[model samples]
Target: MAGPILTAGDLAVRLEQGTVAVLDATVNLGRPAHDGDHTSSSGRPGWEQAHIPGSHHVDLLHDLTDPAALYHFARPSPEALTAHLANLGIHDGTSVVTYDRSGGIWASRLWWLLDWIGIEAAVLDGGFAAWEAAGLPVSVLTPDSVTEIPAPALAACGQPASVDNVRAGRWVERADLERWLRDEAEATVLCALNPEAYAGEVPTRYARRGHIPGTGNLPARSLLAPDGRFRPLDDLRADLAGLLADPAPIWVYCGGGISAATLGLALTALGRDDVALYDGSLEEWSADGSLPIERGRADAGR
Candidate 1:
């Protein structure tokens, strides 16, 4: 309820008043050195070098994901999330602000995850880049020096602490996607990868190449400006003109549910609430030999 997005200046004001807690959710994903190994580097080191003052680092790669999940960045169960949030000193009314150094995709992913539950939080517009551009102060203090705030006694009581308001259908699993394809549901499935990845025109780390069958291409990076901030609402409206006019629910997926969040944030900013994010995305989709994937482009969408 508080935000899907917050400007850097606004966040600064809130920080001045000690009204919000900031979390750096940066995770650098690089092309794998080998065919089977992942190349995700945590942002904690970067956050240690420089970060927004009083901000703590959240491990999106580990703490927030289910280790037992089949793929990377899988959504953790409510119980796991509750304990994780509690560990981070987050409870019912804590004002949370999330940001990332690598563009705003990772930050957007965290925001979407928080939104999936009952917690209300915001993603800092332009993320840490914009914060620095504004001449705001940065801190070198490590997380260990920071004192942990105790969660309220009622945190486990199913108030705001637990996933009391899990946004049903906000997260789409592989089965949900398969069901949509099988039933020919009136939904718009979107792939947020670039044109090359969508077309299987380049090397990919995923088990399979190309995209899910029938998905329209809407690269998530297209939603951001050169400054790594979201584009103007007017520009976004023009870009999404056709899709905005459609009544069907929009479902988005990326390499591993990371970049797709940019589309989710953009659509939410446009006042369209009928959006769902596929968490496993191509990471899980491509691994299965039975699932269908399409190569080449289609004139299905602008």
Candidate 2:
């Protein structure tokens, strides 16, 4: 019962209990340099320089994604994710808290993965910045400084005994969106990318610009405060008013699956558990010339 989100102070207390496993899911993308693409690099260097005590770096770029996936950050198979978590010393009943150096989107991506597989995990509010702002301890110890934690032998250790069933309930595919477009399914699809990308107003790394046709724009960054922490629940509820009022199930997506996960975490925190994320997102959708895409504002006609 830890959280879908945790404050630095709360995580600090949890760390003291010696049962918490902290993972730094940092992946630097389009920052300190804007390449106008989804290209990214590992945040391991940042984590090695300074991190929360006893924390381990989980490279989202390599460790948690599908190696053979055509798009970046595709959700790894359940067996793969289970092994990864176990290697991080996570198992049943292990309280996990994830954080990152940039905007907390990466952390939320891992949190979303855990939530998908029925494991309880939380994102650190404000991420590393908040921890440092609170004058909490930081460490320069590399991941190599600590002994590798062996994966546990339990059949249901860090993942559900039935991982396949749990994963099926949380994700949507490109075909599902196609069905929605054709009116075969009832769902509200929202793009979690920024306004520029959503509108095809800027150059992008994807095969094409704009977004999946008929999807509304809900920039994921809008959900965060200036300091990078998620805004208050009441404020979020206000922004999500229309979607919440709608009876249809919600589906969210982004450039890849990274930023969308931020929306996913926020929605879950607001008690809207019916949300599903499109892992392929624009990376998959835009590549297919056969699929329809929309440019400009969804409500411009209004």
Candidate 3:
């Protein structure tokens, strides 16, 4: 994989030279739920209000996801993703940069998706916050309308069966997770929720509280510094020391699936290719009463 991260200054230079495709992959994770509306939220409105100049908006919830999936943040089929990418002017030769306002959480989500499909992409280290802090330019200008490709026209793109295999390698299903819980599989589970959520002190959108059994609390925010940039590589390694010492495959999960990707990106940057994301995450895991959820921070010691 190419370098997984880029500095704001480097991206600015690329943007000025028109050598790279920039995307504002920002999603407002904290959007208030509307009464009787359970659908996922988006950050496009915020992007329309203010964004990096020349950056196109990618709605992770609507544009890049499988709308038919039972849960939000589900991965889209490769053909669907390819069409979406082509519509956004991203293709085989395009070098892509992704960033978000909430640190790099949402940006990493798109980065991971692009990576799975063999596209060269990177996340802005500190995201929009860092860019603005450096006095970089911002724009309220909407992107030029690209011709929408009909679903039939997309069929010629050739769908590959390998897409499912690629997704299988990057994500873990609930059935596989159950096997792991029964000691039938070998993997280390990591909870990417905030300390409050992990401890069961804060209410979450999930059906239940707390985390899965035998998982460690490594909040996604801990991977980043106060200034929003990711911590130094050595420091990141230290923060995840427990998982690093274990040879078991590392599996990360969060409330929906957004924050887990942040952890996935961080692990990937450390040169660990054995990491996987629980795409359904707590959203699916907690909804089923059959699965056990442990409360408090006691289980975090593992």
Candidate 4:
């Protein structure tokens, strides 16, 4: 079962409630440094300087990713994640708020990833900018005596669905995926992309370009409302349920296969099974030129 999306108006109702954890999930890809200083706050540091009175830091690139494979997917280690949540006093029943500055695009990743890991969480509508516009309370002092507790059980990578698992059922290679979507493969279901990165063609940057051939272009943003919250379950069901009804496994993708994890999370929230995200995505496929890439409506880069 899923919970309601908590907007600023709703969060205002529980400004200082019990056992609520606010997470600053600010993640900005490598940008030119304004100065020669490497010690400067990478996003999480700003949270320390000033953030929601009791907000905790959840660095998307660091805390949520695995060091061993960080260079590869830049994802966090399972142990590191379990410990990170514990430090924030997060547990099975803790209420969670995850947010970032990117119009809920990246924020959606944290929101859904937590769900994959079995935590009940949601994104703060409109992020910190919205919070500031509404005059919410913020402080520079870090939380005191934050406790970290290991999970009774840990699943590496936030329990994100594996590429192997998604290959089953209605999924196909680029050409097949296109045929399925184009009425060529008999699949009239809805589709999703792994992340924003693969929506455009970056041939040399990735193993391939574009998404599964016939799949509908349901960008991760499709599941979210303009307020930066997930749409109502009924609405999600109406749109996504049709895609799954055709019995063709709904396929998802992105560059390195990380965003696909986020897409699978949405499917879980909607209670839709029979769906899979191609973890290899374009990155793995493009590694070899023999693989083909198709340009659909999704190929138009943002």
| Highest TM-score against the true fold, candidate | 1
lDDT of 2 at 72: 91
Question: How many residue-pair clashes does candidate 4 contain?
Answer: 24
What are the candidates' C-alpha RMSDs? Answer: 2.9, 3.2, 4.6, 7.6
TM-score of each: 0.91, 0.91, 0.87, 0.64
lDDT by candidate, in order shown = 0.82, 0.82, 0.79, 0.54
lDDT of 2 at 172: 95
lDDT tens readout by residue for model 4, 1-302? 13424676566555444445667777554422332111213467666676765666677666676566413334443445556766556655566776676555455566645654556677676777778778887677546844222222121233322222212342335565445545665433333553333344322244445654444566776677776556776888887665545554556666544445446656756666665545345555656566555564642221
Query: What TM-score would you give candidate 1 relative to the actual structure?
Result: 0.91
Question: What would the per-residue lDDT of candidate 3 be over residues 1-302, giving only the tens digit for each residue?
Answer: 24798888998888776667778888766632431234446888878778887777889888888998877888888888877877766666567888998778899999888887777789999998899988999887447844232222233334322333234478888887889888898888888988778877776777887888888888889889999999998988886677677788888898878898999999988877888888888878888898999887853533
What is the TM-score (0 to 1) of candidate 2?
Answer: 0.91
lDDT of 2: 0.82
Compared with the true structure, model 3 gives a TM-score of 0.87
Q: Name the runs in model 4 displaced over 4 angstroms.
A: 1-4, 30-42, 70-77, 141-208, 223-241, 244-249, 256-280, 288-290, 298-302
Candidate 3: residue 161 lDDT (0-100): 25
Model 2, C-alpha of 115: deviation from truth (Å): 0.9
Error of 2 at 223 (Å): 0.6
